[model samples]
Target: MATAKTRQKILQTFLDLLSEHPYEDVSLPMIAAAAKVKLSDMRSAFASKLQLVAAFTEKIDTAVLDGVDEDMGDQPPRDRLFDVLMTRIDVLAAHKEAVRALHVAARHDPALALDFNRLEVRSQKWMLIAAGIDVSGVKATIVAQGLAVAFARVVGVWLEEDDEGMPRTMARLDKELDKGGSFMKRLNGLERAAKGVRSLLKRISDRPARRRPRADEDDGEPDLSDKAPAGA
Candidate 1:
């Protein structure tokens, strides 16, 4: 509908204004003026400033997700994860205003924060799947969730500084992944050791014990209760 287009235009205008000023300083009338739409027209599209901000955020999320899926197609797991993260960084850099607005709004909106958390989890799941890791178990799920949150924090730090560009962000990502690889290697070693210990115990328990002379026969006395000591 035409109303939809007008609403989108107003949101875009708001994003444009964000590039010029911080989100806290932006006003509805200023957004309307920038969009060249009347204040009443803007109100018709959104009931309130918060609603408008939410709509803008939804638009940006859609745009970023669309681009992410396209860039991630048919790649190897590690490549996919790297590309996905780099794409996110690039999208945020390109649409800094929209991203900044969402970041600002997330502080005040619990639902928005939840949405962001879910998005990160989804990304981590995809990466783990690509890596051929089984992400169904509780431990795997927790690792994925943790990694996603850590990655998001890294992206946030990158956004906070003007000098930390995409290449620098990508480098940081590589370093983080390297550290993750080391951690995973250590975890795998522990798992292997645990498995070995379990197997050893099973083998020992399953094997028949060597025959020995009864204690009564050796000492010419009846064995008491035929039971091993508590320590044994």
Candidate 2:
């Protein structure tokens, strides 16, 4: 549709400007002019620069999600993750310079860096799910955050890797994922232990309450045996 095209153009124009200039230096008006849309049109498409950046990220997420290979269901988790992440990088290849420029800006801007991390964490959740990884609870959030940080490192290598096959980037990703898999194993152990404790507590709390022993029916001892543990 026309609206979608305009939004895409605005985002592309912003990226093009970022490739040529610092992210801090690119303004909404400049993007509007470069995109050939009126100020109002640009506003209608995106409220601010950060939102535009988030939209661009969502675009990449969609591309990567859509491109997931169904046949990879039988692949090892790490291999599937590698395929998903590499697909992400390939989608991002067209705007490599823009990404590099944004990274430079983030390095100097704490706010931008934090914002970028938040977006990356969100996107990495989908990437994990695409790789058939469980993203269900607090542990899944930690995993996504860790993956986001690791993928950022891979992208750092990728930005400078010029070899046709990107050997360096691929190697870095493999190392990162290998490390991450070990971390996940440890984390899963802890999660299982925690779950066991919670289940035990739940079982203790759900036990039936015993009736108070009547004076006439007293068996010589107070019947406190069926009480749930304190704080259960």
Candidate 3:
């Protein structure tokens, strides 16, 4: 089996090249050459570009999530998300140029976007976990998708943002969080409404069906047999 060390080397090389060139131009041979690895070794580590992207994202996710802040646990959801996303930005700052290039390419490439979206949603699930937020069911799915979009937008800003401190990037992130808060409120309302509907339907379903009138009652005939039967 290829060691983790070798795989990481290959991924990092691809990221470096991706930053310096267009995504369409960055081929497997370029990555292999940049990584100083044989083509065979590079293939062993990553069979294709999509696999390379997925592995790159997984490594980045692990880097941020593996060391979460206990302090964040005591914070509000928005604040926690702010910290989580900002921490990710800090990691991303190193590859801002590459990420910027990828974002532009993905906008024009539907196939790339679709494959990347899968990885992005998966990454956001971990980010939610890091932020002490739930990541399950329909509402959680919405939240995850929203965060993925928010992060992508932030990366766009971060790429163009030249300051060492990234003041503009921070401002954009805050705005996105504000928007997310509003969206979540609406989502919560919808979820509550849906839950209520489900509960009502359950009650209606669980209630015993209305008893039908007996045949004698329906016919308006008394049980004369019973009246006449008592020890007669």
Candidate 4:
């Protein structure tokens, strides 16, 4: 329990620092100092800043998953997804500055952007499952990737929209989800088409091969006469 608290403290301290500073400006030593832990102890909890960020992301994912509304089970998939994503934004409201900082850093750093994308896609998969949406097969990954991008845009709007009701943020989210739903329909159609093509090719490949008659061979024709040839 002490170890867990220490880890949480480290993460919290990092977020606080991130909120006040750019991602590039925050360092491991700074987090250790801010958290009042030994540098070695901080290292034991997290090896690097990226890992710390990833751990923070996991913490958020857990919070969102745990808070999933059971009553949303009967809701349409899009509505369920909207609720889940809005819940995420609500949870992230406290750390808005930190998210904004990371967003800015990621725009300039290709490596950071790529790393964050992986984390976003993974978290989006869980969100999809929470919404009772299918996350199976390769198309599921495409769906997740699309959601991640849409969610990022929503977050961008969220950071800029100061209105308490977040009218703009909600509006943007609704629009993105509508676009995503259309894309999903197209993806499903393509997947079905691909499956049909694969089935046809398999059937063709499984067929028995027909052999051609050889030049010197008689083509299974029966002899009319029962007697042997005169030479015989």
- The whole-model lDDT of each prediction reads 0.69, 0.92, 0.87, 0.92
Q: Candidate 4: where is the Cα deviation over 4 Å? A: 221-232
* Cand. 4 TM to true fold: 0.92
Q: Estimate each model's TM-score.
A: 0.52, 0.88, 0.88, 0.92
Candidate 3 lDDT score at position 138: 72
Better of 1 and 4 by TM-score: 4
Could you tell me the lDDT of residue 37 within candidate 4? 96
Spell out the clash pairs found in candidate 2. Answer: none
Residue 101 of model 3, lDDT score:
73
Tens-place lDDT per residue, model 1, 21-96, is: 7666778888888898887897788766667655654554455556666545566656666766666566557777
For model 2 the TM-score comes to 0.88
Q: Residue by residue across 58-160, what tens digits does model 2's lDDT show?
A: 9999999999999999999899999999999999999999999988988899989999999999999999999998778787789999999999999999999
Check candidate 3 and list the clashing pairs: none
Worst 10 residues of 2 by lDDT: 218-227
Mark the regions of model 3 whose C-alpha exceeds 4 Å error after superposition: 211-232
Could you tell me which residue pairs clash in candidate 1?
none
Clash totals for all models, in order?
0, 0, 0, 0
Candidate 3, 97-212: lDDT as tens digits: 78877898899999989889888998998999899887587777789899899988888888888898989999999999999999989988988999999999999999999888
